[model samples]
Structure formats: C-alpha cells, structure tokens
Target: MIDSHIHADTRPFEDFELMAVSGIEGALTCAHDPLEMTSFDVVMAHFRRLLTVDPERAARNGLKLHIALGIHPRAIPHDPERVIEKLPDLLRNPSVVAVGEVGLESGSEIEMDVFKVQLKVADELGYPVIVHTPRRRKAEITSQIMDLIDGTMDESMVVIEHVNRDVLPELVETECMLGLTVQPEKLTPEGAVEILREYGTDRFVLNSDMSSAPSDPLSVPRTVQRMKMEGFSRRDIRQVSDGNIRDLLKISQI
Candidate 1:
C-alpha cells in the first residue's frame, strides 16, 4: 500500500529501503518548514531528492517516492488566503501529488487560520487533502477536525490519518476515510488487528508513517497478515491493506 504521508528528510533512506523490500509500492514523501528560500523551493527540493534516490531505491526494490508540499496545521492554524497563494504554485510540480498533512488541531487561533487557508487550497484545486488530527488528544482533536470538515471539505475527498482506537466511532459516523499507521508507536499489530475487525474493514487505509526510530514494521502487509489470523477474510484484508488506498489516491494501484 502507498504511505499517504511521510517525511523523508527526518528519516534516513535506509528505513525506506527496508519498507520497499516489504512490498510498499510508493510513499508520498512530504516535509514541512524549508531550510531555505520560497515555499516552492521546498517542493523542488523534495522532488529533487525523490529523483536522486529513486534509482537506488529501485535497485533495492524500495518504495517509489512521490512529493507533496503545503503548510501543516500543526505548525500553524488554517488561513485560507495565505494558503491559496502558496499551494497553487506548489501544485505546479508534476511530482507533487496533493496538498496536505494540513487541517485542524488543538492549537492556537493562528493555527486554525493557517489550516483553513490550506484546506481551501485543497478544495480550489480539487486536490485530495491529507488531514492531520492531534495525536496527543485524539478525541478532542477529532472533534475539531470533524467540525472543520463538515463546514469545508467533501467527506469523500479528505483522508483523516493516524487513526487510533479513540475516534473509531466518530470515524464511522462521519464516513470519512482513515489512515492507520501500524508501526511500533503506542499501538501493536495485534491491537491494530482488533481495530480493523471492529471498524468494519471498509474505507479504511493502512500506512506505515515511518521515521528513523523503531521499526517501520512494513505495516501494511503485517497488518494484513494478522487480520487473516484473526478470522478476517482474504478479501477484507486486501481491502484495508491496499484497496482503500488505491481509491483514496485516485490511482490504479498503490
């Protein structure tokens, strides 16, 4: 399955190398603040890096990387106008896939403004929006995100990521797709399998959300394997592991 969100800058290429060996098709590589010039410059840098690393990546059968550039809501709030200016030009890059890791958070007023701006940018261009809800406070965080999405984004166009046990019901009620990272964070593979069984295994996408710390677990396939042991049908395992992401990314295969 495609990792819908990732930051290659913070993690070494080695981590990605391992994931590719596990059957990851591609990871949409993303980054936040730039070390230098214009916002577009950051977009250019990720694309440059993706091009540079891709052949080496292919040699090792690693996940192919795609790039997306936009302000993350965690850094600031939603601001429609400012985002409008930044995102349109950024999307011009053919390697850039979507506008994201942007959305509501339990941040200050400024953060809300910035998120709204980027969300509008996603809407304007019809780009798929990758929404981030606060990991520290998943329930309160999800409420904030749901409110924003209800007012702005089409439910089908947004992918709410890093979903854990907390907002599972809200996830079903809102009918918004979810991205679950099964790496060695607070959650375990067994625990994640329980979630899939409870969540109905539809419209739920799996991701790895890798970094340098701990194992990536090559989460998609790992989760798929566990679900099978837990009595999940082969068809359901494939649905969450790969099928949903194909639909969410609007691509043929991961």
Candidate 2:
C-alpha cells in the first residue's frame, strides 16, 4: 500500500521502521514548508539529507520511497525565482517523483504567485504535481488554483490534495487527481469509503498525511480494511491504494 502524500521528513526514523512492518510498501515523501522559518540553504540541506536517508532506509527495510520537492505555500518570504532556479537540478534526481506540496494555504497573493510559478515549472518539466489545498474553504482555494492554472497547465498532471466532501464538486469538475487524506479530525476511514462509493475511484488516491499532526500511520491501512468491510472488492481497493499512484509515478522517469 502507498500513502501517496506524506511528510516522511518530519517523522522519526523509527516511525518508518514501523511503517515497513505494517505493510506500507511505499510512500511519496514530501518536503514541508522549510522556507517558512529557515534559510534556503538549510531547507535544501534538509531535502538533500531526506533524499539520501529515506530511500536507503526504505530499500534496506524492503519499502519503496519517492520524493517531491517544492516550496510549500505555507513558507513565506520565499524567493520563487530561487526555487524555480533550483527545481530543474532537483528534478534530475531519480527518486524525486513530483514537484509539490505547492498551492494556496491562505489564497493570498504571494502564495498564488509562487503556486503559479511552480505550476508552470512542473508543466514545463513534464512532471506531476501534488497540490496543497487550504484547510479553510478548500473549494475556494482549489478553484483559485484551477483558475491560475487554466491556460498554463494541464489539470491531468496535478493532484489537488487535502480535499473533502465540501470540495468534491469543485474537484470533480477538473481532470486532476483527487487525494483523500485519512488524518484524524480530517477525513475519516468511513468518510473516504463513502466518497469512493459515491464518486467511484477513478483518478483518486488515498493518503494518511502522516507526521503532520496527532495522527495514525496505520490510517491508510485502516481505511483499506474498512473499505473491505464495507464490501468494496479487492480490485476496487487496489485502484485507490496502488494503481492510481502507480500510474502517476510513471511520469517521474525514475
């Protein structure tokens, strides 16, 4: 099973060891808002360390790992040009799968500016993106991003994440992939199952969004179990758990 969007860099090493034992086959480890309070060099250094440690740890423990590098919207006072300048070189890493955790956190002008630049860069590089929708008024935030990306980017190449029931209609209107984060106080296992039942699993992926807050790493696995209990067939489960992301990962060139 793959937790498609996770801040693996934020978790302790033992947490990954636990994930390995829990049948989590792989994860896309995303860099959080390092630029929010840290220097660019510091952020880059952390990413560099994660790119090295995560894959090695995963490989040694029989788990697969991938990376997504970007300046998160929550990171303020960021130089979009600096990130754009460094992105090309970073994308060259074979383990890096996408450019993301990028999008509007506040739907502010600065956030939108950086989001637009990354969207353009990802489009130019032919890489898939993992977008972060705002916690408040996610529909509005997602709509804002779609508007920004209207002409310059392809919706199909993006994963608009942290979505929920309120934002479903807005997301369904686009060709982009939908991510359901199974974090506590967010989307529950039952809620995700209902979404799959109601909407079908096409262009959908599941994640635990682990290590961000008080959460459960087993959330994805638990969600899968509940889906099974709810009479979703193995093939249906596979589609959300692995197949959708497997297709997305193909764009990585890893």
Candidate 3:
C-alpha cells in the first residue's frame, strides 16, 4: 500500500521497520520544519541530501521512498523566492515527485503570498502540489487558497492534506484529492472508516502524518484493517489505501 502523505524524513528507524512489517510498499517523505536553519542554499542542500539519502535508506528496509520538495508555510524563509527559484532544478530530479506541504498556517498575508507564489511555480512547471491547510479556521484558509489558485492552478493537480470534518464539504467542491491524517489525537482508524463509509473512497486517501505527532507509522495499514472489519470491500479499500495515491504519483510523475 502507498501512504500518500507521510513526513518519512521525520520518522525514525523503528518506524520504518514498523511500516515494512505493516505492508507499506512506499511513502512520500515531505520537507518539514527545518528548525534553526535559515539560509536558502542551506535549506536546499538539506532537501537535496534527503533526495539522495532517503531512497537508499528505504531500499535497505525494502521500501520505496519518494520526495516532495517545497518550503512549508510555517518554515517559509525570509526570501521565499530564493527557494522558489530552485524548484525547477529540484523537480528535474527523478526522485522528486510534487511541490508541496506548502500553504497557509496562520492565514497571515505573508503566508498567503508565499503560498500563492509557490502555487504559481508548481502550475508553471506542471507538477502536482500537496497543500497543508491551517489547523484553525481551516475553511477560511482553504477558501483563501482556492481564490488564489482559481485560474492558474488546476484542482486535479492538488492534494489538500490535514483535512477534517469542517473543511471536507467545501474542499470536495474542488477537484483536488482529500487527505486524512490518521493520528491518535486527530482522526482515529475508526473515524477514517466512518469517513470512507460516508464519502466512499474515490477522491479520498489516507496518511499517517506521523512527524512530531502522537501517531504511529503503521496507522495507514491499521486503518485498512479496520476498514475491512467495518465491511469495506477489497476493491473499495484498495482505492483509499493504494489506488488513489498511485494515481496521484502517476500524475506527478514520481
């Protein structure tokens, strides 16, 4: 199964072991908070290293790892263009899949500006994007993004992550795929099943989002198990567990 949205770079060795045992065939490791590092060159270097190191690490554990290269909104640099300037070169690398984990967090003007700029870049380059919606005022933030990308960005090329109950209806109105983070404190395995039951698995995909959270690496596989127990058919479960992610990766060419 493919976990569509995982910060595998932030995950540990044991987590990889757990993922392998839990039947995770592949995962997309996204660029997350870079902590104290501030230089664009320095940040780009770190992401480049990730492009190299993560695949080798995943191969050793018998897993396939793909990369998504973009500055997270909270970690957007003082000069976001400096990072945006480097995306084309990064996208040329075969391992790099999408442009994202980029979007508004505080819903601040600066955040929206940077997010729109990156969205333009992704649209220009013909790469899919993985957007991070705000934890608070999610509906407002999503609306803001939709407005910014209304003409330039294609909804089919975006995956809105960290989605929950309140924002699902509005987000589904767009053609973008929906990502649910299966964390202990957030959406449980049962909760994810309930969503699948209500929405079916067509535009829906499941993720662990285990980075810095109280979520387990095997959450996706566990969710699959729970869905089966809850009477989701194999074909339907595969749509949510693997098919939807595989289709998105194909669109991103990674």
Relative to the true structure, how large is the alpha-carbon lDDT of every model?
0.68, 0.82, 0.82
Candidate 3 stretches with Cα past 4 Å from truth are 251-254
lDDT of 2 by residue, 106-171 (tens): 898888888888888899999999988888977778788889989978888888898898888878
| lDDT of candidate 3 over 176-230, digit per residue (tens) | 9899888887889898888888887899888998787677788899999998888
- Residue 173 shift from truth in candidate 1, angstroms: 0.5
User: Could you tell which candidate, 1 or 3, scores higher by TM-score?
Assistant: 3
Scored by lDDT, model 3 comes in at 0.82
User: Which wins on lDDT, candidate 1 or candidate 3?
Assistant: 3
Scored against the true structure, residue 123 in model 2 reaches a CA lDDT of 91
Instruction: State the local distance difference test value for candidate 2.
Output: 0.82
Model 1, span 49-145: residue lDDT tens: 6445653554465466676666665443223355457568768766666777676656557667677777777777887777777767888878877
Our tally of clashes for model 2 stands at: 0
Arrange candidates by lDDT, highest first: which order?
3, 2, 1
Q: Each model's TM-score, in the order given?
A: 0.83, 0.93, 0.95
Of the candidates numbered 2 and 3, which has the greater TM-score value?
A: 3
